[model samples]
Target: MDFRFSPSDDAFRRDARAWLDAHPPAEATPRQWERTLGADGWIGLGWGRTPYGNRTATLTQQVVWAEEYARTPHTPPRLGHIGENLLAPTLLAHGTAAQKDQFLPPIARGEAIWCQGYSEPGAGSDLAAIRTTATRTTATRTTATRTPSARTTSPRTPATYRVTGQKIWTSHAHEADWCFVLARTEAGSHRHHGLSLLLVPMDQPDGSVEVRPIRQLTGTSEFNEVFFDGARAHPDHVVGGEGNGWRVAMDLLAAERGVSTLAQQIGFGEELERVLEEARDTADPLLRDRLVRQWAELRTMRWNALRTLGGGPDPAAPSVAKLLWGGWHQRLGELAMAVRGVAATAGPYDWTESEPYELDAAQRLFLFSRADTIYGGSDEIQRTIIAERVLGLPREARGQ
Candidate 1:
């Protein structure tokens, strides 16, 4: 596919860059920043003209917007990305008209934050092995029925599903207003057969949903453990109908690696530049060679990503992108520490002080990047997908 941008695309890039420059991030919180973007019609660029008043941009323009946003310094990590990037695309593909109408407007307006409820303690990489369940139920109120000469009463109400289970590694669950949950909806069904994607509200008034932040090695708590005990979901909120969550979830995963990845690469490039600046005076040939290799690999990854941007049905594209970036990021972290020498091992803290300490950029990068190969999907799982699906190899044996 041709990678060249049209003049209009260049104009869009300039407009995006100017807007980003004019609106300095300053001290805006993540949610405030999201609204800021939405106010300027910067959010939901990929979505075409909708009744919700979202700006429509071409595919190239979307890429340009992502690149420009990443190039901006001190921009807060987007809290609305899961909703705008992942869930929005999935809804466009597999959600009902009502689902889209209900969810898409809030996302486009940056008024709603969403978390994904997919990974479980036992079903992280093997998503089909999920054990969470959504049992169908109904609420009813008495209605008078005229029979013979007397009035009789009957009860009836709308159908809803009671969700019950735990989801670990749920990113931003504590801050989310909603969660798209994958749970078993069929009785006695195994593996992928019985799953349903239910749009559940996170702010349950009855305390059915609970979120516990999981502190990480970097002393941050972006991921959380979410427990749903009898959480309610309306029947109308089911995406792609019931018992079809496996496909919808896969579609969302595919959406995860699109234009946003180019923005991610821009961030990676910035990190690499920081590492290079730290290593500028180093005389060690080995360290210099490693930095050059990293630079080269990042370029290659960008090209590979661009090559796959046409949205062809390449089964291995998403897995390939994941493996490339995951390992590359981990290595960059190691190199960051290497450039920092022994000083990277320590932080600014007083053990006697009641307050907690903070981690510098290098230390935090080194520590957090350790999970790069593990989260999202592990290296082992990615390789298995490429082997069995892309190369037509025999499937790995599993215990029944």
Candidate 2:
């Protein structure tokens, strides 16, 4: 396959670089976001319903955008995972034409932010057990009914959810303007067949939505526990067909895994590069070798991601990339700390401490890498995917 960009794509690259030259990143912290948003015209550099791009855009183009953005010293938006991974793709794939027109433009323009309402106190990895219920009232409206689900398949009303469950570990709920929720819509054998995805408005003027941030180790309530009592969403908010939420959610998850990899690879690579620059003098030969290995692995990930972005979808590969990225980033962090010697645990230096830039970016990366394996399916989970799908191994025992 021809991996190189065509002449037109080369021209586009020149044009994009020239645009960045004209609109250099802002100095004022607040203005940085505005400038970048104005220049890129997207909250993120990867996947979207491209007014200017589509699924057909060359993977090389996607790689160029990701690398260029990562290399820039400018700050990008701290996008919530829900908006980037789940909500945008879901809306584009299944939403009505009007819904796409209304929602996507704002998402593209960075005017709206979104979060996920999928996991609850009792329904995290085993997500099908969710008890958030939506009962349809009129064609356009429904009410939420939420009680803790002890049983896996506790059924309530028809017509979807009148969502009333409390969702915990919701990232950036307080900062979001919208939420994409998966609620129970049917009653039966607790099978995967009974769920539905719904889009709901949050942060209304009337105080209908209450968002309380849950504190984290980072002193930021980047995650939250959201309680929805009698929260109403229109029936039209349902994505895909009724009772098809489980399938729809899986599709969304695939897209999430797919598109998320490109941005993540770039970010991880950036962190690795930072460690190389900042910690290389103190780094031992072995540690430096590990860092080089990680760099190579991350580059491999970028190429794999670019292939996925350009080629037809591959279900098993993203999980593999996710698994490798988490482990590689974690290793780099540990190695960087070792290299830093006594200064590893030291707080930001007198010169750089005041700056919000990642002080000891390695330390920060190390701490965060622990979650990488956990969040988008664990490393073990990814292994299972590779074994069963890619390696053609026998499946493990799950009570499915």
Candidate 3:
């Protein structure tokens, strides 16, 4: 891959920067800025721009936008993972004219908010075992159950699931306008074959659904447990064809891992920069070596992510990039915590008198970094995929 930006990409970068300067987000709060970004149609520039939306933009343009957006401070908005990552790509690919018309404009303009309904109580990492059932009903698609029932064994060829199961760790559920849910729509047949994806609206007049926020260790209610009791969706609400949703979801997940444009890496790189600044004051020689190693890892991760976003479609690169980034983030967090010395156990950022941001950052990093390997997909899972699919290794048994 040439990897150099063609002239057009440079021009597009200029235009984007100029637009950011002229129309910076005026909202005082993060939530308001998220709304402003959605309203301004700036969240997913990939969906809004014609060539990019059509998959015609040069990789350079994509990379340029990613880096530029991440670098701009206090101007561009911080949309939740829903708008920036998951829903936008789904809408771009499989959404119908009416669905796209209904969804994208609000998402682009930040009008209609969204949350994910992927993980169930028992079916988190093993998502295919989800028991939320959406039976085909005359007036609308009717759900049978929504309460947090005890875990049921994965059914074989489930028919009429009645959806009495609960979905945990659902992000931003209370504030969302709609949820992209994965539920069983077919009877019989195990594995990923019988599942279907649906866009279920959240805020209804009769209060058919219940959303209870799941608080984090940091005391922030960033996630929730959503209960759907006899909730119904219109038949037309199904995304993609029957039995085809798993394929659609896989594609979305790949995009989620792959589309780490330079902008996102830049933002991530900021965290490393902070670590380096604080590490310079540390006197330990062993700690300095670890910090140096962490710095190298971050740089390597950024380059790999940039290549994936700008170097066109390189199937093997994304998992590699994710693994690199995830592992290094953990290491950087470790280094930051070490630099905090004995004050690492403090509850808040201001609790430590020495190396305050460094200490607070370490606390945040240590808490958050644990999920880096598991979130997009586990590091073990990604490595296996790379070995089997990319490296052409012999297939390993699923249960083994």
Q: lDDT of each prediction vs. the true structure?
A: 0.91, 0.67, 0.69
Model 3's alpha-carbon lDDT is 0.69
lDDT of 2 by residue, 1-400 (tens): 4556788778767765776566655554433453355346534445544662223334466556545555566745455445644676777678787677667666655556788888888777567678887665533334455668643433454443466677878877877789888887675536476788888888645565788887654445667888877677767778886788888887877766665466666677667777788765753677767767877887777667667667775778678677777777778778677767777776744574665434445676666666766765667777877798888999776564
Q: Output the lDDT of residue 144, model 2.
A: 56
RMSD of each: 2.6, 8.3, 8.5
- Candidate 2: where are CA atoms >4 Å away? 24-57, 78-85, 138-161, 188-191, 204-208, 348-360, 388-400
Q: How far does residue 384 in candidate 2 sit from its true spot (Å)? A: 2.8
Model 2 RMSD in Å is 8.3
* Candidate 1 accuracy as lDDT: 0.91
Residue 146, candidate 3: alpha-carbon lDDT? 46
For each candidate in turn, the TM-score is 0.94, 0.79, 0.81
Q: Per-residue alpha-carbon lDDT of model 1 for 1-400, expressed as tens digits?
A: 6778899999998999889889998878888888888887778888788777678998788989999989888888899999999998888888888888889988988889999999999999988889999999866776898988899877677778999999999998999999999999998898879899999999989999999999999888989999999999999988898989899989899889889999999999999999999999999999999999999999999888888986677999999999999999999999999988998887788989987778888888889999999999999999999999899999998754
- Residue 149 lDDT, candidate 1, scale 0-100: 86
> What lDDT score is found at residue 179 in candidate 1?
97
